[model samples]
Target: MLIDPHLLAVFTVTTIVALVTPGPDMLFVLGCGVRGGARAGLLATVGVITGDALYIAAAAGGLAVLLTAFPVVFTALRIVGGAYLIYLGVQMIRNRKKGQTDDPAAGGMSGRRAFLNGMVSSMANPQTFTFMVAFLPQFIDPAAGPIWLQFLVLGAILIVLEFVADGTVGVLAGRIGGWLRARQAVRRRIDAATGSVFIALGIRLAAER
Candidate 1:
């Protein structure tokens, strides 16, 4: 709560950049919005926020150290996360080529499923936990107050930014869905592009040290 202006600025900028980046989180939300609607996207956003909060809390409590201490755990998480990304990417591509708007299967993706998908996608990424552990403390001033308080404040800001960004994307998708729906070819191309991005992210994650 006793935040320095300089540190606040750093956290704000870092959070904005991270929010803007197209990752599994963004892609998942985007896909949800495109396929389901704003409600589905919002549900997924909530799921992502929940997962992010958990990671932030864990990092703040120094839980990341235990996870990182075991190289095998980190490696296994990387593989699982990478494979999940690939699976999501393929699904997006397949949906892109589909013609039905009210497909029972697509409709069957309940809000709970969307939320769980968001949570599991982010939670499975070891990099997210490590990033939080390393990125948060740099802005905390031990002289001020309890480190946990600082973590809570910073984590709240991060979640708020993510919600805003993802919600905006959801709204935009709703507005654009009409036009996108009319053009099958364009939709297919977008699907291919989405798949490529996910695949690239997966490969990068898998190759990471």
Candidate 2:
């Protein structure tokens, strides 16, 4: 609330970009949506936001210093996260021959299970921690107000924006997936699309500095 106007604008723009960009979280949500349905997708979105909130608070509180002090730790975490993503992608791709036929009557995930999976997926990635530590403080105006409060305000904005953007993607992808599941050809392509997205995300994460 006490942020400078120009700084707030810049921060909003940057946050929007970050939210809209399809990262592992978004791709994961998309995959969930396609595989599980809209409800699962939305639940996953909630989970991702929860993780982002934790990282934001941690960064505001001083975890950022620890990250800065140990460069190797961050890099190691990134590599692990990247590899994990690739593993998931490869598993999905390899399982195609194992009868992944989509059932029109297929049930979606339960709320609790979906939320838990989403939370684990979001929190397991070290890249998320790195992103929070690196990105949130750039717009902090020490003179505007208590630093933590400012971070909370800004972080809240990010979470809300992300929920809207990611939520929409999840819902839409789920619906489209639902429609395509009834078609054999479309189902095959959907599976491939999902796996490719994950693989590409993993490669990008591994390559990032």
Candidate 3:
């Protein structure tokens, strides 16, 4: 077997719990859904999945360890990623204030832009790389047929779990957005709130070691 049955079961449970727990990824999806509608949120989820996939591959390929060995690179990623998030948040805030467009706050993004934004959010997410480096390996059994294969399997499982969990969040958040869209006062407040959340998330990510 590429992985031990017992270990695989435990990994599944642990990963489910991890994905269920509200993290940056989940929150990001929720915010996107609230702002961009269900489709936008799902696209963001896909982008996040893509980023996580890359990180998983990197972790399996020893990039995680190499990153650990070189603190400079990791630190650089943290700073850059954090800054990027902050930039996105600020732009959202500015766009809302400009009052120049008839588009809904969530309506402004095209699928391509949303997907790209999601990709950026996920890829640059400090937690993305760190989680891959810190987690998953613990379940790896050196005796397994091949470590890379095991990692790949585990990574696939994680992606599936995250999609289900985050997808639900996106869908539900879209509902909330639709409801809020009907009430101008509520919609305005929600728009501002979403932007604030993004800023807060960005700052939190930036400060995390």
TM-score of each: 0.78, 0.81, 0.90
lDDT accuracy of residue 153 in candidate 3: 92
Worst 10 residues of 2 by lDDT: 100-109
| Tens digit per residue, CA lDDT, model 3, 141-169 | 88867888878999999999888988899
After superposing all C-alphas onto the true structure, candidate 1 shows an RMSD in angstroms of 3.3
- lDDT scores of the candidates, listed in order: 0.73, 0.75, 0.77
Q: Deviation in angstroms for 55 in model 2?
A: 1.5
Choose 2 or 3, whichever is better by TM-score. Answer: 3
Regions more than 4 Å wrong, model 2: 97-102, 105-131
Cα error, residue 22 of model 1, in Å, equals 3.6
Candidate 3: global Cα-lDDT? Answer: 0.77
Deviation in Å, model 3, residue 26 alpha carbon: 0.9
